[model samples]
Target: MKILVSGGTGLLGQGFLRVLREKGEHEVRCLVRRTSPVERLEGLELAYGDAGDAGSMVRALRGTNAFVHVAGVQYTPEVLEAMRRAGLERLVIVSSTSAHSRFEFRSAPRLVNEALLPGSGLRWTVVRPSMIYGSELDHNMHKLLRFLDRSPVFPLFGSGENLWQPVYYEDLARGLYAALTKPGTDGQIYDLPGPRPLTYLDLVRTAADTLDKKARIVRIPAEPVRRALLVAERIGLPMPVSSEQVLRLREDKAYPYEKARRELGYTPRAFKEGIALEAGRLREIGLVR
Candidate 1:
């Protein structure tokens, strides 16, 4: 099979590429931005183009058996249209579990992308996953790990009881590969999550445990946290943590992975095991001792 993976330089994209290449059964091509560094993809076949451009996407889609649409902006419509125009027989879209929530930041983009899939004349499979954990390249978990490493006091908003089901990056890649290869996954939506769910504070503690350290969690009121996040956003401080993120932390983000398990034979590692693996990766990268 010939596969075209968009956002191939991204964390999940990298994992997928690694898996596909190692499998050696599929011819993998990456659709990367023209300006993206190719040094990381030295030996791989790359289709140089911008995902926002339909022509570029179409050209990238040529001779590909499957299209993995992982290149998407949180609130952009261009991505959906680009995927729709790619003219692939099969498409596997990587979406977030936030799509299921009423949260403003994630709801619109997720819905818009999902809504565009129906009449695209492609065998589409959408995987809605919760906060993905694994690498330092990850957005949410990595930011939190960095914060925990740098800050003396870990701050928690809204009682620190928000449930999060963090799906591992490799697990997500496997699920995507399964969907890309499986026949029954077409035109289906699957929720991909980890084996266990933990609260915000508990998750921080787990990170600490992974590092053999204890995190000092300080609970803050939601309003104050929101105001602080507003200030942080205004100052352009590297604030990956946001009020929207904080609000999301308070919701129960767990989903039954049975669908993925049944359909894709998906089996995710426990949160602890994933965290331990991440800890080893951080140590290897000199991000942690």
Candidate 2:
């Protein structure tokens, strides 16, 4: 099979490329931005293109057996149209679990994209996964680790009881790969989450355990956290945790992964095991002593 992957330099995209290449059964091609660094995909075939440009996507889709539409912004309409016009009869899209949450500000765009897919002459399967972990450069987990490394006390929001299912990046990648090859997956939506759900405080405690440190969790009220996030957003902080993120942390982000498990045979690694693996990787790079 010939596969075209957009956003191939990203964490999930890179994982897919690595796995597919190792399998040696599919011819993989990556559609990358003009300014994206090519070193990440040195030996793979790369097509210079933009996801928002229909012509570029059409060219990238040439002779492709399946299209993995991983290159989408939070609230971009052009991306959805471009994928539709790219001549891909079969597509697997990566959508966030926030798309299903009422607290998500960007939920409208995702809902619109999902609604527009039927009768559009494209066989589509959308995978919505909860907080993705495993990458050292991951936005969520790594940021928490960095905070733990620098600060004596970790800030806990909303009683530290909001539940989250942090799915491993590799697991999500495998689920996407399965969706691409599996039969009767068209028009299906799979919620790919981790095996166990944990509270926000539980996540922090687990991270601290991985680093052999005691995390001093200080419970902070929601209003103050929202105000702080808003100010950070206004100042363009490099690591701005949005007000939406604050709201999300106050709500449950758990999803039913049984669909992926039963249909795609997807089984995510245990949270503790995944955290230990990431800690070992950090140690290998001398990031942690």
TM-score of each: 0.89, 0.91
Determine which window of 10 residues in candidate 1 has minimal summed lDDT.
73-82
**Model 2's lDDT to the true fold?**
0.79
Q: What is the C-alpha lDDT of each candidate?
A: 0.78, 0.79
Residue by residue across 29-134, what tens digits does model 2's lDDT show? 8999889878889988988888777777778888888888777634235545665666557778888777878754657767777777675667888888787887
lDDT, candidate 1, residue 23? Answer: 79
**Candidate topping TM-score:** 2
- Which regions of candidate 1 are displaced past 4 Å? 73-87, 227-241
Tens-place lDDT digits, model 1, residues 1-289: 7888887888888788877877788988888887887776768899988867777777887787787877763412454555556655777888887787877677777887787777766688898877777775777676666677777788677787777789899988888888888878889988888877788678889988887777987777887777788888888877857767766656787677788899999998888888888778877888777
lDDT of 2 at 168: 82
Error of 1 at 224 (Å): 2.7
lDDT over C-alpha atoms for residue 278 of model 1:
79
Number of the top lDDT candidate: 2
